[model samples]
Target: MVRISQQRVKCIGCNACVEAAPYRWRMSRKDGKCTLIQAVEKRGMFNILVTDDEYDANVDAAMHCPVNCIKIEQV
Candidate 1:
């Protein structure tokens, strides 16, 4: 399974994750920070799954995040 950490303290509100993985990431209106609104489910395992085309986009977002808040993990 893949998952993103929910610690909002590290988020810089840069919206990198939102741009990289639009399907997985979203911006919160209250704070303008990027977050995962849904989980990626596959084969009974939950992953931080994004489309193949979104891989680079998401990676780029993670890299560009000023606070380095976005965490992509495999479980």
Candidate 2:
């Protein structure tokens, strides 16, 4: 499994994550922040769990994040 976490409040809507992994991330029309697909919010952070197949793409997303708000980890 893989865990993806995003500090949505810190997002600048730069579109890096969305570009890297469109299947897992999207831009919020309501707030202009990048949204972690199917994520659950807790303590101002958004998190989602996915199969290991997602690891590489999300890792690219996290690495490309300008504000470094996105994180990917093996679980």
Candidate 3:
């Protein structure tokens, strides 16, 4: 399962996640942050759904964030 830590998401409204994983990610206008819309179902646990094809791009977006926020992990 893949997960992104909310604490580390500074979400500059770039919508990179949304573009990369349209089925799973979105931007929350209320909070000006990007959020995962779907949950991964595996090992009796739920994590954010980040597709394999979009993984590297999303990770790059996170790493290149001006605020240095965004956390991606697999468990």
The C-alpha TM-scores of every prediction are 0.60, 0.97, 0.51
lDDT of 3 by residue, 5-62 (tens): 4442345777766675565567787887766566544453335655466567667656
Question: Per-residue lDDT for 1-75 in model 2, tens only?
Answer: 999999889999999999989999988899998999999999999998999999999999999999999888898
Clashing pairs in 3: 8-70
Question: Of models 2 and 3, which has the larger lDDT?
Answer: 2
lDDT, candidate 1, at 65: 77
How many backbone collisions does model 3 have? 1
lDDT of 2 at 67: 98
| Pairs of colliding residues, candidate 2 | none
- Candidate 2, residue 74: the lDDT equals 94
Scored by TM-score, the top model is 2
Measured on C-alpha atoms, candidate 1 has an lDDT of 0.62
Candidate 3 Cα outliers beyond 4 Å, as residue runs: 38-57
Q: Which is the better candidate, 1 or 3, if ranked by lDDT?
A: 1
Question: Against the correct fold, how does model 1 do in TM-score?
Answer: 0.60
Tens digits of lDDT, candidate 1, 25-74: 78889887666667554453333654455555556666777876555655
